[model samples]
Target: MVDIRIPRLNTNDASYVLVEWLVDDGATVESGASVATVETSKSLEDLVSEHAGVLSRRLPAGADCRPGQVVAVLTPPSQASPPPVADPGRPEGGGTPEAAPVSPVAMVITAPARALMRQHGIDEQDLAALGRSLIRRSDVEALLAGPPAGVSPLVTPEATPAAREGGHARPAG
Candidate 1:
């Protein structure tokens, strides 16, 4: 079984609130799948699964989980059923008839797109200009070619010509 710990979002912080589970309790998940979402002081991030198996939630939604704490467990397929737990904050490892996975947002993006956004400092509005719900690296590249006519450039108009060539434009004062 693999322990899904709350990752340390910052060096000075030790805890974060469990926002919600992307996958339902007792649901099967693949390695690197985003199982849960957590919120720290800085930002929110998905808690990914390390192993492919059935997920067993160890904490309810909105619980304060510390970094390195086991908030969930993964049981292999052969094991099937999750063992029962009477803990108030924890749920029995099995599918809950009432729970459903959270639906993704319309503009949900792939990991590569997110990485490109971070690297290029591209904002959501920039991607939205592409007129595509799913953002891709090539789409970002196209935007980098320069904003469409009549649209405000991602970089500030006052930016040095050299900065514009780099694809990052600072907003004018």
Candidate 2:
């Protein structure tokens, strides 16, 4: 058996988000395969499997995983057992039936977006209104802000926050 750990992608983030699973739990996977994705503060990195075996997923997509945490295990096919479920009473897959994906394909709400939605008491139906392929933290914030920017209130060059604060507009490097 092989342990699939969550690597420390950056120095700043203590925990990372499991963006999505590339393969299903208890499925066979090849060595060096990207089984899932870990989302950091700035980017997402693939969680590669070091061993080719039957995958036993311990964490679901969209859950928080910390560095050095075992998120899955790879068992040699000959010795592979059923993916251990925390709850024997539960079905083969983890999570409640209501925990199904919002859509069959595309449109994954990042952890930050989920947090913001919870904080603001926003509903998933509200986000469904956006009809985006991917929903990020910024998208949720924009929804909370209401109306499209530059629709009702357009800040003039002179009235810009930077300008008013005596800071000039500078290109980001």
Candidate 3:
């Protein structure tokens, strides 16, 4: 069994909330796969798995977890058991579900960057040529300001007008 301990955010801090679980508890995970998202007072970070095994969450989302706490447990394949509860955050209830598809060039982006992408209907594929693995809000801003020639604009012209005006886009009536 492998214990997934939460790293101390800082010497001054005692605990942090388990903001979200990217993978459901009792799911089979691959090494280096992003397993969850954690937040500190300063920033958000992804909890990546180091071993390929069955992941079992020890703490629920929104729980206050201390640094070096074993937030999860990993069991070898033959000894793994089904998760005991429904995970509303996941679609299939429990077990390691397949990871969401992401562009090869896309890194796990920041929340603000994600929000901006959602607002503009832009996907990581749209930014592939930028040659960046980790994308930030500033990068999105710069891209919106001007994309290189030949690259299609991320937002539609109609949506652009509304975005510029600080309003949301509407479907054509």
Name the best candidate (by lDDT).
2
lDDT of each: 0.71, 0.76, 0.72
Candidate 3 or 2, higher TM-score: 2
Ranking by lDDT: 2, 3, 1
TM-score ranking, best first: 2, 1, 3
Task: Show where candidate 2 strays beyond 4 Å.
Answer: 82-108, 111-123, 130-134, 137-173
How well is each residue in 49-145 modelled by candidate 3, as lDDT tens digits?
Answer: 8888999898876567788889998899889875555456786765456668884532546566767777775667666656765566788778777
Instruction: Show where candidate 1 strays beyond 4 Å.
Output: 82-173
TM-score per candidate, in order? 0.48, 0.58, 0.47
At residue 82, candidate 2 shows an lDDT of 60
lDDT of 2: 0.76
Error of 1 at 167 (Å): 48
- Which parts of model 3 are misplaced by more than 4 Å? 82-173
